[model samples]
Target: MIDNTSLAVVAPEILLLVMACVIALVDLGVKSRLRNLTYGLTLASLAAVAFLTGSEAATGETAYGFGRMVVSDSMGNWLKCFSTIAMMVCLVYGRPYAGDRDMLRGGELFTLAMLSLLGIFVMIGGHNFLVIYLGLELLTLCSYALVALRRDHTQATEAAMKYFVLGAMASGFLLYGLSMIYGATGSLDIATVFKVIAGGQVKHTVLVFGLVFIVAGLAFKLGAAPFHMWIPDVYQGAPTAVTIMLGTAPELAAFAIAIRLLVEGMLPLAIDWQQMLVVLAVSSLFVGNLAAIAQTNLKRMLAYSTIGQMGFVMLGLLSGVVNGDPVFARNAYSSAMFYIVTYVLTTLASFGVILLLAREGFESEEIADLAGLNQRSPLYAGVMAVTLFSLAGIPPLVGFYAKLAVLQALVVSGSPFYIGLAVFAVVMSLVAAFYYIRVVKVMYFDAPITATTVAAPAEVRVVLTINGALILLLGILPGGLMTLCAQAIVRMLSS
Candidate 1:
């Protein structure tokens, strides 16, 4: 067995696990008035874990004797920080909503979210097939339960059912791919697998076939085109808080896993997978954006938009086009990571509004529902506009910065395809802007559907303030921020 002492590297994850269990036990007999206690415990532990991770040496090496099963790098560290912050925001937004409904949203939900975070950390660091599989399943299992957190809701039940049935099949596909990769390379470790492929001694067909399965499984996780059918339903059906977790946490996890496998394990075969990813990216972009255009439900629309965003992320990962420079890999990767962080925050803020809007019998799921919101409350309207503009990739927002980096990355190769894709992405951003701006327009320009609807809580308003400021701050002064992203990604890859 691996020596337990080596777990110091994973101290954050360990703390989170212990805290999760303790929270669950404490919550079992806790009084209703004290439900917020679980939130406190979770936040304290999460904050500690995040702080401890900052002290981890940036060795960029595999850990203990999982024998290439785990690795940690600056990339994982950065992503984890964002994921932890996002989950904490979810807890802050979830506390009142869960309590209002008398739901078991305290320790149980917190525990599961923490477990899912552990899986994400592992997924990001996996240096071997076994670790990746383990991380994937842990995340999946946690999500399936999370989807059904409101067990009484038929929509939640149905979504969970669909997620489980399809998720199991995807897991099976993942296993088959891993087995094939092992068969081709004679190893489950990523470094060894890469070495085997790099040597050109392995059978090409088996490696390629295995890659398809792995890519397909990842595609499902990311809710990419052709594999994204479940996303709309799941996002629409799950509790808004749960949807927030899924949208933000799982995407980061999936992005990390993709990078680990494609960039680290399968680097030698870039020519093979790059083309495939491009195709997937293009398809996802069109399908996701076009599908989103028709959806009236806010959550479902954002779900499709998330898929579209992933397509651009894939393009960034695959394009490797960096300005006029030939070496664009690191820039491209960093830009994608930055984009994911921004996306997660923008998404969380939107969902926070949804949670605040939701009551025992009503959920603010429709566009019309927010009509004249600006007239009623300029503050909410302003926050909503910030989110909408960010999503639309307008100037000065972090979203614009993300797209600019991607476009710059794609500009490296200077190919017609790259140019066309950049243009297409820009065009789609405009299209997306229409939908997002519509929300703002309705919120501000129209009359309120009801005068005495409900006022947003102080916490919700605070969430809006923080989220809006970040978006605008990054937009206005993106240079220093990009420098930090540059440092993080460069060190991550080089070390």
Candidate 2:
């Protein structure tokens, strides 16, 4: 029977759903070119949701709802809070860009984005395999529609088709794996599967087979190497606003599910899965860095850069269960969490700058488009430069600390293998620095492509400044956020 506690557990999600529907209907009456009413209502809803989730996370309570199909715990609540805030920022930065391109003729973009965010909330709270799968499908379906929202553009339509076909296949892989696990354990609940696997009653070969498919699906979602074919095309082809929306908050959702499935549900098979992660991480580093070097398009380069960054996340994840010991589990997972959060923060600033530079009928996609950006608009150039430097893992930046935290986790494992992997990651970071620095150099040293100064809405400028400042501020003093992540992970594990 549903109770008050159950309703409270999903208050934010319920609020988001209702607001999305309301905004859709209200947007039908919105006659402004910018859909100001729809935009304001969406932001207000997101702010309220963020507040609710933040309050829940701060309480550090764990509550199970829907007969244990979903959970509201510190980790999930914090992730939801962060994801909501990221969505708000994405809409703010994307509004002008979307308006200029005539993509806001209807309220579909606002409605679709909220629905996708709601899907992310479900994925984070899901405690059962089927619930997680349902959430995944909801998020992917919305994404496909958003990518194709520019109905008149051939490139956008093509990107949507590619995303649909590839996403469908990945979803199938995940579903099949979940089915095998369910068949083996006679349960769809994550907690039940964990206890069953720990009991060692199931066939090891069968479990490992299912795990292979599960990891493959997850790698595809994370845009890791070998399964990241859809990212670059979609990023380049879709509207820049849509690309940022797709790239930012959805990533936190992917990380949440990774923790839910791999760490919480299937950790008994750590020995088996950790090895698979090693291969994926190393290959992603190699492929992401090398391929990025050949790209002239900024979005595609960042897409490849994303693959390389996910490798770091994988490294942190694999280091959690060294020699079958889970002593470092909290630290490792927290480091991974920190890495992803900071990555998303830095990505917002980078993409915000890109969105600002792009004018009507001009894509501003090529690296050459940023030539002498420093001379034209020092503020955005500095923001973009800082973003690129952080991505390269340079000293005293959030990216450097993120990489350092992961490497530190590996080294603390007392495993020569993990330590060596850390060294390899460092080398790859060095390789990645080349492309990132090249972009910086273009902005600072190259001749200006246009003499007109870059302009932005006052709100965009304020948010962009804060976003860039956070990168630097967090890099300098990352302890508070790092501690929060560690505490959240510990609470989740203990509860």
Among the numbered candidates, top lDDT falls to 2
C-alpha lDDT score of every prediction, in listed order: 0.80, 0.94
Name model 1 segments beyond 4 Å from true.
Answer: 1-5, 57-65, 321-326, 453-457
The residue pairs that clash in candidate 2, if any, are none
lDDT of each residue in 311-363, candidate 2, tens digit only: 99999999999888899999999999999999999999989999999887887
**TM-score of every model versus the real structure:** 0.95, 0.99
Clashes of 2: 0
lDDT of 1 by residue, 236-281 (tens): 9888878889999778888888887887788777777777888788
lDDT for 440 (candidate 1): 82
Candidate 1 backbone overlaps, count: 2
